[model samples]
Target: MSQSGIDLDRSLGYLLKEASSALRTAMEEVLRPLGMSVTHYSCLELLAQRPGLSNSELARGAFVTRQTMNVLLQALERDGYVTRPAEAPVGKVLPARLTPRGQQSLEQASAAVRAVEVRMLSGMTETERSAAFRILRSMIHSLRDGDGNDGA
Candidate 1:
């Protein structure tokens, strides 16, 4: 059988790409005044949520490589936004936590981030929004499973 025009696969891919780009642009605009990129904002948010997590753990959580995470950590440290506590007992890798300044920045950034999110979800009904979130999370889980299909 021959496929007709507007295949769902292609249409969905385009929609996802456009939505992602739009959201990223909105976030970057909100963060620009604070001299922060989306990458930096994400790192700060994650660190805030999981204080004292190791660099490797942070990298994994942030969906970045350890090298990329190291660079981000160095910048955060230089800006007095994060601190690596003194080494723990033998054979333990000391974890990093946000500094007071970091917490302050995060608080400020959170408001801006929330504004962006509100704008992004402006028109959706509550149930629609909930379903969309669930579907997206399920899609992520399926992709991470690496089964070469969306598992729909």
Candidate 2:
């Protein structure tokens, strides 16, 4: 068997990476004025949707390391955007909740993020958008499941 370099223009992996980079750039542009990074917004949104989430849980939800999430939580706490008790109520797990301020901030950031998504899907019809969503979810599931050896 022989191998050749990828044709970047026709490569699904390359195209996905390119799309991810563009999406991140667009999100950053929209979030900057709101004084939020994607991670910051993610944490708040997570807390909002699932109140009393532990640091480890939030770290997973936000796709960040525990240490990174801890630092961000500290900053958010000091800035009065989030609240956690001084001591863990049980088992060294200090569940965090968004403060009213955090909720307000998240509302704005969510709106900004939604705008970026709308812009990204602007060219697609509703059916195309639904298909795109399903396809992307399937791709994520396949990658995460890691069922392999059938073919590359």
By lDDT, the best candidate is 2
Candidate 1: minimum summed lDDT over ten consecutive residues — where? 1-10
Write down the lDDT of every candidate, Cα atoms only: 0.85, 0.93
lDDT of candidate 1 over 61-126, digit per residue (tens): 877898998899988998899998666644676588899999999888889999999999989999
Clashes by residue pair, model 2: none
- RMSD each, Å: 3.6, 2.6
Residue lDDT tens for model 2, 30-72: 9999888899999999999999999999999988999999999
TM-score of 1: 0.83
